[model samples]
Target: MKKIHLVWSFFCVMYVSLAIAAHAEEKIIQGKEEIEKSICELNIKGQIEKEFHLYVTDGYQEMADGEMIYFWGFTHAKDFADVEEIKTKAERNAKLLPLKVPGDEIRLTSGRNYVVVLHNAGWYETEEHSGINHVAHTIHFHGLDLIPALDGVPNLPYPSVFPGEIYRYLLTIPEDIEGTYMGHCHVDSTNHIMSGMYFPIIIEKKPNEIYGYTFDREYTLFMSELDSEYMETLREVGDIRRGLDWNSNYFMLNGRIFMDNLTHPLSTINDPKTRIVAYDGETVLVRLLALGYEHIFAWHPHGFHGLVIGTDGRKFPFAYEKDTLLIGSGERYDILYKIPDFSSKRKCLSCNYGPGISIAHDHNMKGMVSGGIYPHGPMTIFDIRPKKMTP
Candidate 1:
C-alpha cells in the first residue's frame, strides 16, 4: 500500500525530530559539596536531532486522602522516546536522583520555587565557564521531625547550578564500609533522565567480619516509579511538583503494595481479631531498601533459610546461606530469618495463625506491575510473633 504509507510517513517525521533533539539545548549540574565531600551532576548537551525511544514507568493507583495511595517514579523519558528513525547521536545522555523533597508539599512547594531560580548555589566566583571537573554547591534540608509543618524548613538544600538541570541530592556515605555504591548525574547532554531527574544512594555498613549480627526489630524501605506524564513535565518545567508520577512498574519489598495478602478476620480467642504466631527458633531482623530502578529484592523465607547479614548498607562477614536474597538499586540488606513452626493442626494459639508465611518479592522480571496494574506493584510481607502468645 504505497510502501506502507511511505514507511509510515518517514516514521512520523523522524519521531518529531528526535523529540526536539532530546529536549534541546540542555545543561545541568546540581551540587558537589567539598569540605568533606558532596556531589551531583547533570550536563546532557543535546544533539539526537533525529531519532529516539524511551519507556519505563509502570505504577499508579491513586486516591490521595481517601486512602489507597500507591506511586512510583522514573521513566528515563519512556526509556528514550520511541525511536523510529532519523539518525544522529552527537550526544544524548542521562543521570538522576538528587532528592531533597519536603517543603510541606504543595507539589514540592511549587517545585521548590522553580528550584530557587533553576538551582543557584554559592562559591562560584567564576572559573571561566566553570564547566567540568567540579564546582557547585548549595544544599539544605531540615524536615522529618514527625512532620510538624516540615519543622523549620532549612536543612534541605541542593540548588547549586550553572547551566544545570536534573538533580536530587542528599549524600553522606563517609565510607560507611561494605561496598556497592552509585550516585548518578554525570550528564552527557541530553535526555536528562527522560526529564524527571534521578535518585538512589545509600551507605550504612561498618564494623568487622562482614556484618556481625545484632538486632531487636528493624524495617527499612525504598522502591520507585513515576511517569505521570513525565512527572507532570518536570513539575511544570522544574517547579518539581510531586504527588505521583512513578514509573517503577515493580521495584518491590515489604508488602509491595495494596495486596499480596491481608485478610485476618474471624476471631474467637475471645474474638478481638487474632494475629500472632511464630515459634521454632524465633529470631527476626529484616531491612531491605532498593530505591530507584534496577531490581532483585528477593527474600523468600517460606520454611526458613535467611541469614544474610548485609549488602548495600554493608554488614556481612558471618551470616550467609540464603533461601534467596539479592537486592539492588541503591541496595541494603540485613536479613536473619528463623520463624517456622505450625503443626498440631497448623497450631492456632486460640486462633492466631491466619497469616504468617514470609515472602518479600521483586525478582526482577519487569518488577511486578503498576502501569500494568495487577495488584498494584512492588511487594511486601512479614508477620511472626510468639512471646508466649496472647491476642
Candidate 2:
C-alpha cells in the first residue's frame, strides 16, 4: 500500500511539472505575437506629413528685354512668431522674401500627405502694375488624380480663391506615382498661366524600391513662354478676361532667357531655381516640363543623346534613346543624359578642353530667339568637366 501511494505521488508531481512547462511556453508565444503587432502599429503611424504655405499675390517679373512685366503668381510665406510680428519680420527679411516668379518648387516623397495652404493676398500696385493687376487665382495640379473638391478649378466644384481668402489643398501622393508633375492656376488658365502662374512638383520614389537606374545629379527644366502683349493688356485693363492673341514674344527656361540661364544656371535673377551641373562620365536626370499654353518644344542636347526613361509619372517599359524630344504643353519627360568623355574635336572654347560646355536648347528656330534677339531664348549650357575636376 505504501509503494502504490509513492507511485501515485510521483505521477501527480510529473503532471504538475508538465502543465507548468506548457503554460510557460504559451506565454512566451503570446508575448512574441504582441511585440509583432506593436511593431506593425508603429510602422502604420510612421507616415510623415509635409506642409507648406503659399501666398498668391500680384507682382512684377523682369523680362529679358529689361522690362518689368506685371504678373500674378505665388510666393512662399515666411513663418512669424505671431500675427503682429509679421510686418517687422517682412521688413527685416525684405531681400530674403522677394516676389518669386514661377512660384516655388513643390517637392514631395511618395507615400506621404501634403498640405499646402494658399493665401490670396490682395494685389498691391508695383512699378509695373501702376494701377492695374487684380485677379483671383487657384492652384491646379495638372496631372494628379485628386478629389473634385480639392481640384483648383474655379466655379466647377469650388470658387476661385479671392483676395484676403485662404484655401487648403490636401493631397496624398500614392506610392506608385513617382515623377515630374506641374501645378498652375486653373482660374482663367489661359491668361493666368501665361502671366506667370505655374510651378513644378516632383515626387520621388521610396528608398526601398528600386527606380531601375540611379543618377548622380538631377535638374528641373521648366520651359515656358511669355506674351508681352497679353501682359500689357492685363496691366492696362486689370481684367484677365480681355481676349488677346496668344503670341509668344519671349521663350524662357525657368523664367530666364538663354544668356541669363547661362549666367545664372538656376532660377532667374528674381528667384533661384534649377541648374545643370555635371562631370564627364557621370549621369544626370533632367526633369523636362513644358508649361506653355500652345507651343511645343523640341529639346535637343548638342553633344550627346539622352535616354528617355520615363514620362508622366511612370517609367517606360524600355528606355528610348534620342537626341531631341518633342515636349508639348503640360507634358513631363524624364530624360537621362550621360555626359560623354571630352574629345579634342568636341572641346569647348572656354575651358581649354578640360571642362567642356555644350548648349541644350529648343530645336525650333523661332524658340531660340527672345523678342527678336538671337541666342537669347530657351537655352542653357551643360558644363561637363573631367572626372578629376570638381563640378
Candidate 3:
C-alpha cells in the first residue's frame, strides 16, 4: 500500500509540471503571433513609424485654357537632414518650395493608428486673387466617425488651424470600415473644398481577408469641379457665404484637366491620383468618388464595362456590370474592371476594338469640357499592356 501511494504522488507531480510547461509554450506562441501581426500592419516599406506633415499654402494652377486659377492647397513638408538644412533651403527658394501641387493621398490600413500633423504655413498672394490670401484651414474627413475634437470643424468641435499654428490629429482606421473615403477642409466648405483642399482616404482590409472580391491593381478617381467665379468672389469679398451663386467652369479628374489625365502617370498629377495601368487578363479595381456639391457625374468607360461590386464602402449582394454609372455628390463606387485577353477580338459597345487604350470619361457631355473646350475635361486612359516575362 505504501509503494502504490508513493507512485501515485510522483505521477501527479509530473502531470502538473507538464501542464504548466505546455501553458507557457502556448503563451509564447501567442506573443509571437501578436508581434508578427503588428509587423505586417506596417507600411509597404516595412517602416513601422510614419509621419506626414501637410503644409497649407496658397498658389496658382494653370488650367488647360491657359488661365491661371488662384488656389488654396496643401503640400507635403519635405524632410531635411537637420534644422540648418531646412533654414538654408528656405532662404534660397522660400517662394518656390511651398508652392507645390495638391496634397498627397492618405493611405491607411484597417486597425492601424496614424498621426496627421497639420501645419498652416503662412498665406501668399496670387496674381489672380491679389486682395485675398489664404487663411485658417481644417481637415474634415468625410464619412469618418471620429470624436468631436478631431472632427476638424471650426467653432463646433475645434477651431480652425490658424496660420503658423500646428495641430496633430490622432486617427485610427477601424477594422470594420475599409474603403475609399474623402477628406477636405470643413472651414467654409463651399469655398475651401472647391479651392482644392481634398484628397482620397483608402483603408485596406487584412491580407488574407477578402472583401467580396479581389483585384490585381487599384486606381482612384476624385471627380470634382472648379468654380472659378465662386473663387473670385471669395477673393474679393473674403467670405464664402457671400459667394453662394456658384458656377463651375472647369471639370477635373484628380485635380487635372483631361489633357493632364492622359499624359501624366498614376499619382503624379494630383491628389487622389487618376491614371491606371494594368496588364492584359488582370483584374483592376477602380475607386470612384464625386466631390461636386451639386453635379452628378455619369462615369463611362469606352472599351469595356465594369462590374459594380460595392458602393459607399459596403459590398453589394449581387454584382452588376454596366458601361456607365451615375455617381451623385459625395458618393463612392467600387468597380472591378477585368481585362480580357489581349489576343481576343472583342468589340466595345461604341464599336471600339479591345486590348488598347480605353477612354474613361464622364458621360455628361458638359463634364467633358473645360471652359467650352470639348474633349478636354475629366477624361483618362486605361492602358492594358501585354504581360511581361519574369527575369
Candidate that scores best on TM-score: 2
Best by lDDT: 2
Instruction: Please give the distance, in angstroms, between residue 189's alpha carbon in candidate 1 and its true position after superposition.
Output: 22
In the range 177-212, model 3's lDDT, one tens digit per residue, is 787787788887877777878877777885322365
- TM-score for each predicted model, relative to the true structure: 0.30, 0.77, 0.75
The predictions' CA RMSDs to the true structure, in order, are: 20.4, 19.0, 16.8
In model 2, residue pairs whose N, Cα or C atoms come closer than 3 Å (at least 3 residues apart or on different chains), thus clashing, are: 266-274, 267-273
Determine which window of 10 residues in candidate 1 has minimal summed lDDT.
Answer: 102-111
C-alpha lDDT of residue 290 in model 2: 91
Query: Candidate 2 at residue 176, lDDT?
Result: 83
User: Which residue ranges in model 3 land beyond 4 Å of their true spot?
Assistant: 1-49, 79-102, 126-134, 206-212, 236-239, 260-273, 343-355, 389-391
Candidate models: Cα lDDT each: 0.35, 0.71, 0.69
Question: Which window of 10 residues has the lowest lDDT sum in candidate 3?
Answer: 80-89
How many steric overlaps are in each model, in order?
71, 2, 0
Error of 2 at 208 (Å): 12
TM-score of model number 2: 0.77
Error of 3 at 58 (Å): 1.0
